[model samples]
Target chain A: MSSKISNALRWIGFTSLEPLLKLIRGEEPKKNGLLVFKKLLVPILSVFIFLGVCNAGAKYLYNIERERKIENTRSVQGEEAAQQMADCIDSGDISCKPNSLPSPADVWSGAKTLVEDHKMITADKKEFKEKTAAINKKRKKQGKSPIEYTGRPSFVDQIITSLKTVFAGFLLAALIAIPAGIVLGLSETLRSGLNWVIQIFKPVSPVVWLLLVSMVIKTILANADMDKSFVISFISVGLCSMWATLVNTSMGVSSVDKDYLNVSKVLRLGVLSNVFKVVLPASVPLIFTGLRITLSVAWMVLIAIELLAQSPGLGSFVWEEFQNGSSDSNAKIIVAMFVIGGIGFLLDRIMMFVQKMVSFDSKA
Target chain B: MESVIEKKTMLECKDIKKAYPTPKGDFVVLEDFQLQVKEEEFISIIGHSGCGKSTLLTMVAGLNDITAGDILLDGTAIAGAGPDRAVVFQSPSLFPWMTALDNVLLGVKQVFPHATKKQREDICKYYLNKVGLGDAFHKKANDLSQGMKQRVGIARAFALKPKVLLLDEPFGMLDSMTRVELQDVLIDVWSKEKITAIMVTHDVDEAIFLSDRVIMMTGGPYAKVGDIAHIGLERPRERHAVLEHPDFYKYRQHLLTFLDH
Candidate 1:
């Protein structure tokens, strides 16, 4: 008993200590401080600080610009606009009093009044306009363009809307591609026949497909809103990358061990349960790998289509920035590129994590 | 007498003939192969490599369509492979995706469809424990050693409580030590469960040790049952003693001579 216990202890100690001992005996940890600063820490910290300063500066400039623009913009007193609109509606100055919620009729009547009589501004508007003219004079001397286009949505709104559209597009692509791929993969007749068609279209650029689909939808399906070009582009991306998933699933299913089929027979696992229990589970690793590849490709291809199709998404936002052709746009493009790449990496990691959870070989 | 008659005879193959189409012509693997298995009777078929031993087993398991003749269970012709018959192949044929317990549960649920989830779990646990794999129940089938995988296969077959258990060289792939250990465990389970078993093997001693009857097959295109010798070795035969038994060598010598042709 004592000998057995000693043997157990020796084995445990040897395994635990061997790696530490190897590390301790490793080549000298010398002269690394200077090398580390040059090779590692300096570059990392430099980029970090540079981005930090740039982002803060951009936010600060944007806020100042917004405040200046809002001040210059003309508007009735909130109290006065509300009172006149309420009185006009309540006292039957118009056909019907607009609701407290400010119906379209109320906004239109107010807009009409403002346009018809533009001399209603108080002294505060005059002072604001004088200050704006002074700033404009100072900017002309310094060689800067005058701020243009009041009433545009803020930069924050544009960024938020772009993010929302990208997410929605990703989800829509997954929903369409996965089931289609699974069905296509399981049937040999479908795989062979459809593969030819897929091969033909797969090489065609998603941008080309998006344009084709958009034109088709516009011509043939004139009933739906043409503004749903984003959905069209997303569907094109899904279709374009679906072949990878279909091929992988078919290959995975085809490669299942012959013994499993025989075992299924002996155990009397009927057709449907055999599919779920044996065929599906055995093919999961390959299928999920295919899904990961498909998702990543779809994500990238959809973004490209969105940009080319003039759709509402991060791709479109980035394209707009590039079209601006400004000095700041270069930095914004770099940021957006990183954002796109980071989201792709995050999505791949999520798929890999799910694969690990569902696969028979979870250690992978 | 009561146990012998009342106990089930799970499988009976009458003049089972199977042939394969070849480039040159047709090649018959099994011709007039017949077998009768009583409940819990461990029967083994031993023959040369191409003697159609496996072909016979497949027909008995209803895996292959018999070219001629019939396979019956309780005097009924088998429609196809059914849960009433469970097979364990030469290599552990457990689905690689399933854990050991899940593999057993697969068979249990199919055989006993009306069984509750809890009941199926218990049945899986009981059989896995019977095969001495109680602790490794959750390990994936591929991760197991050859012996452990076969153990799972055995547990899966037994868990279903099939009327007949068909094992095609279940221990043929294992090292000798694991082979004997598993053989002991299998016989013990067979004694308790009394499910008729038909095993096809190349090992002479395995046949002598496990089987009530060892059916020898002649070789190729005209392969048929060469001999059906009763091992008739006493109950719960000892491993080392059976190896030394004079009659054991006689049986082994007879099989060696029969398969040599």
Candidate 2:
């Protein structure tokens, strides 16, 4: 049972848990305890340390801004104006509050508020759906469309939307890049012919891709009944992020071992079979390396694309909070920042796990 | 009855040459090579390194382009690599991601495309078992040892049921112990299948031990057949018996003398 758990942990690329499993198995408790401290507890302690530093930093900045504001009021107006500003700041009035980095507690409170807001919005949506169900049923009987939910998306809703967009973009990227990469890999002439194009386009920013996609998509979808922003955002994300997978795939395919190709040849394998059996399997390690990079790049660039396209995702959510500039807005943005980073880390770990599973000889 | 009917020519290399263009001029590896391999022949080409023995074998396998002349298999000019001619390279070259069975099955599937799935699987399992990999059938090629990988390589080649088997020093990378062991495995399979084979080797003992005819090549800059020694050992030759044969030293002396030149 212990060995089985260890294997499972290793398979999922979670070696950090192995030490704890060993501890549970009652072998080398001191060694395992030390490992647990280094692996799990140290990282946890570091996170607390980081939060403490952030709390101190936020307080220092807040006081600095408050003092600057009061000094400015005294210089521009009078002593009375400065004292009034100080009182308003202490009272936590929005207009007089210092716009500074939010402490950990503020971010926590911001997360709670978003969750509460999501719950209330979900209830409202449920009520709306229930209220409109009968009328929609009548409308459907008369060959009419049912009522659609057009309410403002909550933070959680925005996160889901972001995930959907990133996935769509990733799929589009893999679809376009893999075939193109294979073609490029197969023919040296084609690879050299298109090298310049790949090189020039690879580092182009997501913002530019978003603009380019928007221009073409808007014109094409002008008369079409489609979510133009969503289409544009995803297309831009795919284009902006596909280069890593493209380059890696081509490199991988081209670098397939000559000996494996000999095996393919001796088998009298057709081109498709040769590629599927020999070339692709040999190239998969590098291709997955490329794909992992592609996914991370897609996730990284998606926010910019979403923001530029005005798509309903985290980008838009953060943009709205920034524009609102309320006392809690800084806290909300901090929450969104951590959420984005945490999601990106999770996505990378998932891809790493997948890469490990399909590797040539895992646990060999 | 004509004796020509009994002794059919399975492969012919007519004035074959291999050369590469270099900064100074053409660097010729082999030139004016002429040979005929009778059906079911076990021929070993042995020489010092860089004598283009491997180049010749690859040309027969249709992997390398013939810059001059042509190679014919069964009266048809061999084109690009085909299942009719199977090759076991210097290294196993088994697809690392696949199981040993799958590696063998890959070729079996291609060669016997019309065969039933069960038949093809049976063919793979049979060969893998022959190579003593019955227990390691499901083991990934990457996890297999050097000897085991070469065993799979041997299994894969034999499983194709090729008219001709080209072994480019199939056991060249193995340790001496594994090499000798695989030598027996190879000969046993080769003799059982009754397929004509041509092997390139620098190991003189291996050449003598495995071949009906050991064709020695002169050192390079356009190497050709330097000498040939026929091992007149008895059928289904055992290693100990062949090694102890009175004429074994004579044949061994003859090969070493040619290599020395």
TM-score of model number 2: 0.94
Cα misplacement distance, residue A248 of candidate 1 (Å): 1.6
The candidate that achieves the highest lDDT relative to the unseen native structure? 2
Worst 10 residues of 2 chain A by lDDT: A355-364
Predicted candidate 1 versus true structure: per-residue lDDT over B94-150, tens digit per residue: 888778998888888878889899989998999899999989989988899999999
Q: Pull out the clashing pairs in model 2.
A: none
Flag clash pairs in model 1: none
True contacts kept of each: 0.97, 1.00
**Candidate 2 lDDT, A302-347, residue by residue in tens:** 8877877889999988888999898899999999999999999999
Residues A1-364, candidate 1: write the lDDT tens digits: 6446545544333233333333345533344444445555676898788766766665566456444433333254455655554554446543332212222233344435433333333243455667688787888899997643333233333445554554565565456555555666567788777777767876788778777877876777678755577567656676666656666777777677878888888877777887888888887888888878877887778668778877666677678867875434444555556567877887787788788778886655
Local distance difference test, each candidate? 0.73, 0.90
What is residue A103's positional error in candidate 1, in angstroms? 54
In order of appearance, the predictions have TM-scores of 0.71, 0.94
DockQ, all models: 0.56, 0.84
- State the lDDT at A334 in candidate 2: 90
Deviation in angstroms for A66 in model 2?
Answer: 1.3
